[model samples]
Target: MERSQEYENTAWASPVCDAQEPRLAAAISGRRLPCFGRARPKKIAEGVGSLNVRSMTGRSREVADLMKRRKINILCVQDTRWRGNKAIDNWEMGTSSFFSRANKEGREGVGVVLNAEWKKHMVNVNRCSNRVMSIKLMYGKVTINIISAYAPQVGCSIEEKEDFWEQMDAQITWMGEEERIILGGDLNGHVGRNRNIIERTHGGWGVGERNEESENVVDFAVAFDMAILNTFYKKQENQMWTYCSAGRKSQIDLLMCRRNNLKEIKNFKVINGESVAPQHRLIVIDFEMKEERRGRQQQTSRIKWWMLKDQELKAEFKIKVLDRMVEAEDPDTWWTTSSRHIIEIGEEVCGKTSGKDPSPPRIRNLGVE
Candidate 1:
């Protein structure tokens, strides 16, 4: 519903049916749904859900708090004031950050950040326009492609936008079909504008209706096999608006990706914050990445088994368990009775050293078999 509301600035045709929106694969139209800032306010909770936002400047602390409290996994920002030296320096500890904001002089900008845990997989880094940057992630076999963008404003004209995509598309073409490509940021084009088109997620599976340039962009995404996430609001009053300049609100900011790739899109909502917060609310979304489950399982099992071994082998473990205890020349590093199970390792070692059978044992003289 709110997805269509971005058209409020101009009159739009009757909305398209949900089954007719653009599809990455012809038969998978249903895979696409209302995207961030496109779905209606009612479709999503006001201030709760996972999210990635654009344009958070001088607000790293507040953003960090929000991420920790909400556990946000990814963040893409555009026009953030972050600059050369101080950009990464100011980030909250424990967050992996990639930023390309306006240079110290402040011309144009873009950036991205993720949970610090994601640092392991950071792969490709691309900077386009002063306002765009693309990052590739590899989590084992799973890949995530994220881009932060700031499209040109009205004064910049459609040609600028046309040029913008030309360069961007050229840069990211190496991405794989299976990769999850997300392009989001301060896309200045308004919903349903002559150049900014709004279409339904269900019907014809192509851009709903376009002026000329709009359709071209849509065509490119389709050619690239990308799906534009749809919205919940029906282009009516129950809006999914993001900008409120001149006392008129409209949808602008957006998050997009291959339609079928989002595992389970629980929903999308706008978090209306305090007056001090940006007028554009945070568009929170809940999506499960099915592909990540396997690696997560492997990591969990690996870590569980690893730490388990490390703990049981404490008698031989050189790593200090407690900092204060390290200086004490502790008699037994792994001797905690709580961890008596590790006794098997010690007994095996002892039995071998004393020339005793390993399996002959009674509990009292464990070293002997």
Candidate 2:
């Protein structure tokens, strides 16, 4: 048994279990494990976090370490600032990274980091543009589509913002109906506190006042039936704000999931102690995923019948069969036991045949079958 350790100054909760101390879902090893910063285990969702890392090239290893310690299985990162699409599988990081970037300039990029276990379940990756990327993961029968997006900033043109939403919607529409969507990144919008209370999708826990971009984001979520996860959970003022500066603090980075999936997601909050991005804090969400059960496989073996054609092989097999037959208690027992003995001796005399049709019918001047 592994000893459990405790950490201070960190809060944890799960909406699904409604427990004071949220429990993490089981790990790949079939063992229940606790998260680093929080103790007390209750059944909670797999950890998925979003961080505006600003740039990921030189800090990939550092970010991976932070995620591993935090027990995050999958992470969506924005503002990568890379210039192309690439997947990083470094041993030191102990995580796999897939990123999509602009073709011209190193701006407005998005990426995803999956732990080693989760990477094996990845079905496919689609890099639509620098601002949009989707990765489909198969957990048994369930196919979950996780999209990482970097929306246009408040200063960007109206045409650019419209284009970004259009592109983002296109990606969502492209997915299959059964596939679950977990979209997260720097949406560059604040849904605010008061209006969120009145909205169906918003849970009234948002920070600050709404801006034009915030209205756009809320409208987009309402149109798509996605629930703003950050607005659903109550947390401290600092924990609600994803972006902070010397004089200004705002809630721009957000995590959005299909409104139907709101129940599966437990806790959503911001971690301010992270050092990856000075302006943006790491936002973490916990949700549960169903794991498939595997059944045991049967064992089998084959005998080489072609070896019987050889006289020497026949003589060896006969001797072994007779020896085994003499040791048997009865005629019926001898018939059952001697057959395997004959094959065992024949294998020593002549090699076993390959599982395939050992001698395929030779086709001369082959034509269409």
Candidate 3:
């Protein structure tokens, strides 16, 4: 189960469905349909993605850009191969907590990157080792613990893998019932397609045969009551495989969440294109949070009175106002109407505000006018 290099086979098979004729026609006519089992719009769904960048030294910014285009809120990074245990900020990419080798060349590093919106909620980061790292973020009323890890390959010693799982178990035990947990990264194991036997964790949509490593992954999930998220949704072969090598493909990199929160997961699939990492495709899952955000306060933009400072623009505004309000009955309504028309003319003559308008300040216990 060691991570393999790039493979040769990149061919994709057509989806098997009743409407294959139209889909095939569309394919032939150079039109592409959305991926199978892709979720439509959801009221509470939030996009989270994971990718093994192999090395995140110079490519972190590119990966962040890809996530932005895909609308990923939080992304788990693995195999960063960075040298330190400090946080790296790429400005546009937001902030990444890199936990890597403290001594020699960094390998098997893990990191977590949050979008600008989520970065403010980040509290503390725990760098357990080069193989494991965790970040805590407060989302409204609930706390979310996101653990990013890179598991040992099958060739590694059993003690190493066991110790890794033990660390993970300890991390999970640290969380309370109210706090949510998401453990994701390159586990380097296949959970297989036998959902009936492993009903507690596997979702029956996994490909390939089960092996000893797969058993290890399954045992870890079963012990912690977590579900392998990628297996829940049906997808094309290309969309299921997270790693490809030598015409061989496998679903090793995965995302797991508490079994109780499994219902919130709307879609999980391997995304194609945006190939920042050639070996691994991004895995994005959409899930709804328990808390809904409050409605935004209503407000109107202020008129651009600065435009009137220019003499030429002031003359233009005067001419437009005169033409629109020369003859008006009802003086009060005419003044109000004329003001709006004059403001429109001023805005057209010059530009409006440059930055985004924030919500108006809330007043505390103030009487209405």
Candidate 4:
């Protein structure tokens, strides 16, 4: 069946409980939470996803299946409600899960799931709190920080909301300027379709109308020089809503990244037809690593200098180069013509090298001799 059709037929189940209110008392009392386990490598994903699973208590298999079917490499999950800080490996499914939750059960929690390919690249996991968690991966020379957050809902107190934003601010500030970040969460706010004062952070393709809570989201983006990636793409009306319940819908789930890295995002939108979470749908963004792309181009453009060792090929290349290097009017023109002809003829005769050296140099030990 079509995904959208399945979505229409699937029954929307009410959440077992409302979103956990920000635990203001603990924050006020200065109580320290246990640090989550740290896991270790880094390869950035082509497709990254975010979903508020509502409660991931018994849905590990289901979540893994969904990720595999959708080809999602990394997933940021909110409201995991999985107590304790540890890593869960589903070897059969080829995915790794890590979570951070409140001491109490059935409350705010967040986690990140990485496919087997990316799992090896995970360098660290920071279970910042029950409401926010992050994982860092090394992708070539770039460090990617993927944060999963669950903010206070509208019913939560102002202080609680403030605390959540403060934690988010601290998390982003702690990251070095050279690092890249992809923050995904059920922030529970409507950024709306208007960019206005927040044009630098908002893409203006959002749904619904702006509210105070969403204003905080926009303000956070602006302050951190991040862009709300979800709002940058135009999608079907149904595909624009991330949260749906009781005949009401809103685009509260969001994915964000640094504004300067916006060009790396190729596509971002809601994924309908999944019933993993009855109330919240999955949203994904497709991005490419700029360094990886450049590396591939550089490798493919390298000349096959090793082939020059062949006497016949070398003679042919020399003749072709001499034919193309006609006398020029000036010294500058002559040098340019000579260099270009040499390179062009060399490539034509010997061809370009593959990504790697076909024959590596051999090492010899002279001590024994």
In candidate 3, residue 365 scores what lDDT? 38
Which residue runs does candidate 3 get wrong by more than 4 Å?
1-45, 93-103, 292-369
lDDT of all predictions, in order shown? 0.53, 0.78, 0.76, 0.82
lDDT of 3 by residue, 332-363 (tens): 88788877887777777765654457443333
TM-score of each: 0.55, 0.66, 0.65, 0.66
Worst 10 residues of 4 by lDDT: 34-43
Predicted candidate 2 versus true structure: per-residue lDDT over 1-369, tens digit per residue = 123334323334434454655657654343445335443434423799999998876987778788888888888999888787777765454555554555467887888888788878888999888888889988767778888988898789999999889988899888877678999889888778875244778888887888878877887888888988988998988788888889898999999899877777878978888888888999888988444345554433345555556666677777766666556568788777776776667677766545555454333432322
lDDT: worst 10-residue window of model 3? 22-31
Rank all candidate structures by their TM-score, best first, as comma-separated numbers. Answer: 4, 2, 3, 1
Counting only residues 3 or more apart in sequence or on different chains, how many pairs clash (N, Cα, C under 3 Å) in candidate 2?
4
The total number of steric clashes, by the backbone 3 Å criterion, in model 4 comes to 5
Local distance difference test, candidate 4: 0.82
Position 64, candidate 4: lDDT: 85
* Residue pairs of candidate 4 with colliding backbone atoms: 40-122, 41-121, 41-122, 42-121, 42-138
Model 1 misplaced regions, further than 4 Å: 1-57, 84-90, 96-98, 157-159, 193-220, 230-239, 274-277, 292-369
